[model samples]
Target: MATKDDVSQSARGLLKKVKQRYMKSADFNGLHISTIWNSREDLEAAAELVTARLVEVVGPSDYMNIHIRPWPTRRKVADQIRELRELSDDDYGVCLYPRAKALKRTKLPKKCEDAPFAKAMARGRSTLELAFFSADVLESYRNDARFRFGMGDFGINFWLSDEAFDGHQPEKDHVGLMHLGFAYDMRQYDPEVPNTPIVRRVAAFYGDLDDLTPEHQQRWASFQVGDDGIDPHPVWYASQMGHWPDGLGPFARLKPGAQSYQRLV
Candidate 1:
């Protein structure tokens, strides 16, 4: 039985193959492939190779573009804190202003204070960053008559929510929707690479992704899945920094089950 992660991996692999076939057939029409992941290191490593291949195949000219949109750390912290406050009466507070002020005053490492979103928000400016593409893709698929007609046999259902910070804070429950992107792009590429069987196969796989609909794909893509479960904040933070909490120094356990419930035999 393939897990959702397994399915996602398979889907990505098929998409890569389809893209390759399409490039070969269409004289490389400046196809751009961008991927978002939970780890900057992993994303960078993957992008290096993919970018090289794209350059090799398309010869620049926007023929290949690969970007790794790691989760923004400072923005995530702000979002998490805001969410925590919204959920419960707990003083789930992070000293955003103090942290920024300290960094500025001391001229220490600017990493914490230098975050664009953090800096902007720290100044008491109203800000909203929308991950619209992810939403737009799903909407396009859902509303487009041509796409819907073509995908008649296929059905895609998608839902988006902030689940990464869930259960972590006593407040509002989950972080706001900061990280957003679409997982369904089969239709977008299908017509462009109709001649390529690989493209067709990839489209078919996604077309038949019944167990996991487009909504499920979107949710899973947004949240980070781990041994503990879905944790968006950790995933987003780790993605931005390219390291997990374990990589950081000693911190309280983010997950449970470490303590022995009973003495093992």
Candidate 2:
């Protein structure tokens, strides 16, 4: 059996490797650790060992971890929209697209008029869907079996460190570090497994804003959101806007006859 000191040493080595690899790779800020190691067990074991130290350095509320499973079919997205429509309040969601132009027209395209996800982006309309529903709704879904392996497709975390620490903090004053979680990468889009659940935890180390390079600044900003922003599908209108939410009203009128998930491959 591995001694406790051996395990800690191994975990420290893994953390150092990931932190270095994460900085060197483009867009690796929020990429899942599993993608780097190709093993969920390794990611979990590493997280278990270092998470306590991270908590000591980073505050609990400053970090986030989540499992995001994309809805595979258009029908599934439509069903979710129908249920969301029943919600009376729209505070959790805000419209972020077409910010350049105001809604000059109130009508949506005929082909997408009836689509549940379609929303008229006229003035004062909130179209993006926020994952704000009750937990019971997820529990009631029949496709719950897919949640096991399918949900954790991306798993990662992020941390901040200055040149003084060289991306590794001292034993003391490490409480603010917490586990930052998963994100979606459009390049990994698998048509056969469109709904594959992603499990990601992200941790990054950065110096003060003044010390960061321009590229580092951009990478730092991108991970603040939960997505990598590389999808090309029209159905991914919202994801293109940075894992925000899909906006179909504009796409429908602009690109008629286009179907959801049509260009995913």
Candidate 3:
């Protein structure tokens, strides 16, 4: 039988190895540690080991959360993804995408007329518009049952395309070409009880800025609100000017009582 010290040492060694492997892989940037164990005791042990190692290696400032699940089904996975997306305070963060093809089909509305973006900007309406796949759809993978995987809390999913790492510079513009957003369900853990406090605490742990302070307000003036409860001068001006490549001079000339400038014609 293995002694307690032996088990502890073994767990620590495994965690160290895992962390080293992650650091060696260039593709694992911003990746978080997530694990699934065979038993509750094993899960807790692993969590403690992983958390301690991560804090020592990555620092205590890094935001980390351990998710424990008895048996995670497709619906359970989808629910978890949804919850994380809804609670995230970061400007950019992780979300779940069922699969590559499913991720590709996800898109924002093309036309501004009926789109949520247009409605939010023009009518001051804020609503969720993204389509989340049903659990039935998520479990459609051929090998999904063979392997058990866990995503970091509030982690994003990508289709793992060849173009993903192509020309991927840390400083330069590295746009995500293929991704899908998802949320998770924590209903089983807390049925009817709100997780607002937990979510806020996590946001604070991550140093995520949800609401702006007075100092931040002034600093972000160009990108923030204006006196008329609208966007700043440039943005408001652009909206009234339409989405044309040229300046607003052409559109302004069309207004009534405006000078018939030759250049506008």
Highest lDDT: give the candidate number. 2
lDDT of 2 at 26: 33
Candidate 1 regions with alpha-carbon error over 4 angstroms: 1-211, 214-235, 239-242, 247-256, 260-265
Q: Estimate each model's TM-score.
A: 0.16, 0.21, 0.19
Write model 1 residue lDDT over 69-159, tens digit each, in one string.
1112233333333332333223221111111221222322232132333222222211222121233334443453322112211122332
Lowest summed lDDT window (length 10), candidate 1: 199-208
lDDT of 3 by residue, 1-265 (tens): 2222344665544444443332233221222323222233433344344233221112111222211110112233333333333332332332111121211222322222332223221121111112222223223221333223222222222222344335353322122211222333332345467653211000000011112232322222222211221111232223322433243344555766546443463
TM-score of 3: 0.19
User: What residue runs in model 3 are displaced by over 4 Å at the alpha carbon?
Assistant: 1-7, 29-42, 50-265
Instruction: Give Cα-based local distance difference scores for all models.
Output: 0.27, 0.29, 0.27
RMSD of each: 26.3, 25.7, 23.3
Give me the displacement of residue 265 in model 1, in angstroms. 23
